[model samples]
Target: MTGGHSGRQAYTGVPRWLYALAVLAALVVVLPLAAMVARVNWANFIPLVTSAPALAALGLSLRTAAASTALCIVLGVPLAVVLARGRFPLLGLLRSLVLLPLVLPPVVGGIALLYTFGRQGLLGSTLEVLGLQIAFSTAAVVLAQTFVALPFLVVSLEGALRTGGQRYEAVAATLGASPGTVFRRVTLPLVLPGLASGAVLSFARSLGEFGATLTFAGSLQGVTRTLPLEIYLQRETDPDAAVALSLVLVAVAVAVVALAYRRPGGRGPDGKAGKQASGERPTTAAAPGGALT
Candidate 1:
């Protein structure tokens, strides 16, 4: 009886410390966000947020972020599918290269963009011959945002594809479903949660992007100036408005993550499934020889 009580005490005591640490970590993360919210004046919040420049910046931010996210999905989904399931020499190196944007400083990314798209850049001469200019325009802003946000979408989708089993896909194939049908009806549904989560994350990251947008796209109001740019501009003049704008960005990011959490098939970290279907084809099962399966 004594041994049983001591064992029980040991098990319970270890978790208590862990619980305390978790609470402390939560507090550390939440306090700064709480402070930002508390600093805003509710009375002037509406007028401050509704100002023409603020509204324009917000509109551009949303439009560009949405457009960039769409582009990321179009370009990233295939790359992620390939990287996650395909086998090739230097594939590991390729995956690491894709994640460069996530680790590299945004400023460095902006500079890289300039070298690639600037007037004297490698492709710049060709673009100029076609009477096209990419620098410091609305299109430039979208391109810059897309460059920074694409990696988030790709990485997230790859993880989803890896963990969301291919059992349904295999079952679909056994039922004589066409490759396109299997992907559309089976694989897509299973990874829908990941797609949604990745899109939200990409949108949030695009909206908050500052350095790259400013450096590559420039900070022209009603053109390339996004919410972050607006906030930086306001900081030197109206501190309250700056704080308010910061709060709005924070609120939007939190709302996106909250919505992701509320999505269907949303599982907690510990509740997530392990490895998805291995031996599945990199492409859809419809291809010849059924390589993608």
Candidate 2:
């Protein structure tokens, strides 16, 4: 195909009417954000967002989101690898259960957590005996966030693992690399981008978590109340503050998602940027052996 024709086909291959639908889809997302921005009280946006309650909620949200994302990475990576690479009975059932949070109501998850950790709950009494109270506390908030956000990381990394296949892994094993060495040198590197993207998505999901945190951990200023819960509370009393905080959340989420998709060295998918666009042929190195070494 001619370069210009190929470029045109890249975008126009879909049905002509789909372009209109695509525009409508974009509008559905953009219009609400536009209205929110328009409603923001620009005059007091700074003061409103900087208020003590707002700052506390934002700080709490950031801290819990970070903690939850770390937890998701530690736990979800292994789960994803198992789902994608391991063979066993009822594997499909296990995979579905792991991804349940993606579709389950946040409130239901919270209630389940509450029953597991609340006083008189299945494990709560046992925990209480050990003096480790969890429900209605900051730790509950982290658990709630992790419960809901874990699926995002798992889904992302599992898809990446499946897409990447086991070619490099097999090659590394053939070259005398141990399983751990192959994973560290071959599998992890191949899936690093997906893992990073998944972690960012998990952080974003945790940052916005509300129903689970509220139902399991009760909203308390500077404790379990995250920015979403703060926005909910402020909406009833001070819409201006709510709007300001919403904008802050939106901005942070946008920045994080942008960072997740950003390419190394700021190059586009076509690899056309800076001196690389000046006809320097990219070189490919030998795989497996060099990587295992």
Candidate 3:
């Protein structure tokens, strides 16, 4: 049977103080956002958000976020696949290194990117010699976003892969399917929901990126300024417009996450298809021992 019924009972043993703490934690996050919403000038919300500069910033943010999300999928999928399936020395260290961006401060990441791609920097000098400039440009915005957002996709996809296991893949290989065929037809389909969720999260993160974009991309209107950058700039001049834009961003992020996670046909949070909804237990492949591997 599914844990939906049992899960409620399992939580009954929790101490009452834990619930109080949880509420306090929730309030800490919710109060600020509520206050920001309250500060928004509803009378001019539409005009504030639709101003020429606001429109340009919003458009650029969307474009760069989309591009960054695409780059994450393209580069992160292979990295996740290797991380999940490959066996190698120092693999754990490698995984930690790959995920470093997730924990590193955004400004530090921007500095790293600047050194790697800035003119007179590592690869930046080579590119400059070839008549290409990256730092302080729109491309830098996308790159900075991808640098910070890639780890989200990797972590999500890698976790999904680890949980889903490799039984189906092994079976496909035993049946004479080539590695490529099995990956395309079986592996990819199985992890698609996870990939979709990761992409949405990456997009949301990209939309909200600020420190790195400002540090590296240099917020030129209609060129590199994103919504977050716009909001930061507006905070100094027009707090009302800033509040309105912040609310817009918060709404979009909430909608994107909720829409992505809303599974159909009784699918559960685990991304299984209808099994949990039907009160069926999710399957797990056992290891050589009786316990889970």
- Which candidate number maximizes lDDT? 2
In terms of lDDT, which candidate is stronger, 1 or 2?
2
Taking the candidates one at a time, how many backbone clashes does each contain?
A: 2, 0, 0
Cα RMSD of predicted structure 1: 5.8
Error of 2 at 249 (Å): 0.8
User: How close is each model in CA RMSD to the real structure?
Assistant: 5.8, 4.5, 5.9
Q: Encode model 1's per-residue lDDT on 1-293: one tens digit a residue.
A: 37877666634336678989999999999999898888888889989988999999999999999999999999988888889778999999999888899988888888888778878877777897899988888988988898899998888888888886566677667767777787676676566667777888898889999988988889999999999999999999988899899888888988877765563343432113223322343344444654343
* lDDT comparison, 1 vs 3, better candidate: 3
Q: Quote the lDDT for 54 in model 3.
A: 93
Error of 1 at 239 (Å): 0.3
Q: What order do you get sorting by TM-score, best first?
A: 3, 2, 1
lDDT of 2 by residue, 1-293 (tens): 66876766545358889999999999999999999999999999899999999999999999999999999999999899999999999999999999899999999999999999999789999999999999999999999999999999999889878876787678777767778877776777677778888999999999999999999999988899999999999999999999999999999999988876777675532223334233432222345655445
lDDT of each: 0.81, 0.87, 0.86
Task: Spell out the clash pairs found in candidate 2.
Answer: none
TM-score of each: 0.83, 0.88, 0.88
Which structure is stronger by lDDT: 2 or 3?
Answer: 2
Error of 1 at 228 (Å): 0.4
